[model samples]
Target: MREALIVWGGWSGHEPEQCASIIAGMLEEEQFRVHLENSTSAFASPSLSTMSLIVPIYTMSKIEKDEIGNLSSAVRDGVGLAGYHGGMGDAFREAVEYQFMCGGQWVAHPGNIIDYRVNVTRPDDPIMHGIQDFAYHSEQYYMHVDPSNEVLATTTFSGEHAPWIEGVVMPVVWKRRHGTGRVFYSSLGHVAKEFDVPQMRTIFRRGMLWAARD
Candidate 1:
């Protein structure tokens, strides 16, 4: 069985524990040997490299240098990393290395919790296949993303919330590589309940599996 690690902590507003639990349940159902930890220290485990995948549900938290270094090494060595929303994107705000590995960072969410649409930009990608454009009544993330990311989905700002960004198209989902590891991320799942949306759930599951090359 493939081994997966899920570490949750940091901002409670993101409901880290609950988010970790939701993903853990999905991974378990997929036959992954899921290990859940509530502390970032878990990233320091010497055996972290053995993991087939790692999902972090930490937001805006500070991670130690050595701990993050181990994580970076593990991913570069082929351990897949996948995450969603601010939990992964906004995590380690002070750690540029972590942001680079994630391929993006959450900068703002205009019109906090409003109706928006997520367009499927790469429907042919396995992670997005069979999923159509969907509407979300949640925070629409405005992020600073790595240009190298293979964008799979996107959202165009309506300018109703933020005038300057009116026509800006931002990446909602993307996949990239950090050395030998596949990295996947989605600017969704602000709260645990967001996973209840079928499209959101499906995309996330497929994204995680894709990252692990499962």
Candidate 2:
């Protein structure tokens, strides 16, 4: 069975613990052996390279140099890395390498907890298959993303909240590679309950499986 390590902590507003539990259950249902940790120290595990996938639920947390280095190296060596929202995107603000592996960093959420629409940009991609453009009620993430990402979904700013970015199209979901490893990210799920959104949950599930080592 594939092994997955989920490290949860940093910001309680994101409900990292609850989100980790939800994801652990999802992976367990997929027959993966899921391990859960509440601290960033888990990233320093010497056995990290043995895991098939790693999920970070840490937001805006400081990571030691050696810890981030080990995590980055593991992903570069073919271990899958996948996560969503502030957990991965907003984590390790000072760690450029971590942001690079994630393909994007959460810069701002114009209208916090507001209504928006997500457009399916690459419906043909397996991770987005059968998913359609849908209405979302959460922070509309404005991010600085890697142009190399294979963007699968996007959102258009209405200018109602942040006028300057009006009509700007931002990536809502994307997948990329760091060395031989697959990296997937979605700018959704601000809180644990967001997972109840069918489209949100389904896309995340597929994204995780898609990033896992074969």
Candidate 3:
């Protein structure tokens, strides 16, 4: 069976443990040998190098150089990395290398919590498949994303929240390649319950499987 690891920690407001549990259940349903941990040190495990997927549910927190190095190397060597929201996108604010692996960083959530629409830009992508543009009432993430990301979905910002970025199209979901590994991330799921949204949950489920290595 394919092995997966979920490391949860950092800001508690994001409900890292709760979010991890939700995803853990999903992975279990998919038959992945899922292992869960609540520390960044889990990134240093030798097992990580052989795992098929790594899901980091950690928010802004410090990661040791060796831990990040091991995780980065594992991904580069074909172990997939998948995550979402601030846990993965806004994680390790000071760790440039980690952000590079994720292909984006959560810079801001203008207007805090508000209603927004997530437009599917590339319905042809396997991750998107039958998903369509959907209405979402959550933090519309303004991220610093890598230009190389294959953007699959986007959202337009209304000037009401951040006037300067009005009408700006921001990437809400993207998949990219880090070496031989597949990297997936979505700006959705500000909290665990946000995954209750059918489309959001479906997109995330597909993203995780798509990123898993053989």
Please identify which of the two predictions, 2 or 3, would achieve the higher lDDT against the true structure.
2
What digit string (tens of lDDT, one per residue) describes model 3 on residues 1-214? 9999999999998999999999999999999999999999999998898899999999998999999999999999999999999989999999999999999999889899999999999999888999889999989999999999999999999989779999999999999999898999998998889989999999999999999943
Segments in model 3 whose C-alpha atoms lie over 4 Å from true places = none
Give me the overall lDDT of model 2.
Answer: 0.95
What TM-score do all the candidates reach, one by one? 0.99, 0.99, 0.98
lDDT by residue (tens digit), candidate 2, 53-129: 99999999899989999999999999999999999999999999898899999999987999999999999988889
lDDT of 2 at 60: 97
**What 10-residue stretch in candidate 2 is worst by lDDT?**
205-214
Task: TM-score for candidate 3, please give it.
Answer: 0.98
Model 2: residues with Cα > 4 Å off, grouped in runs = none
Expressed as tens digits, the lDDT of each residue in 96-134 for candidate 1 is 999999999999998999999999999999999899998
* Candidate 2, residue 181: lDDT: 94
User: All models: lDDT?
Assistant: 0.95, 0.95, 0.93
Model 1 weakest 10-residue run by lDDT: 14-23
- Quickly count the clashes in candidate 2: 0
RMSD of each candidate? 0.6, 0.7, 0.8
* Model 1 regions lying over 4 Å from their true place: none
Error of 3 at 169 (Å): 0.3
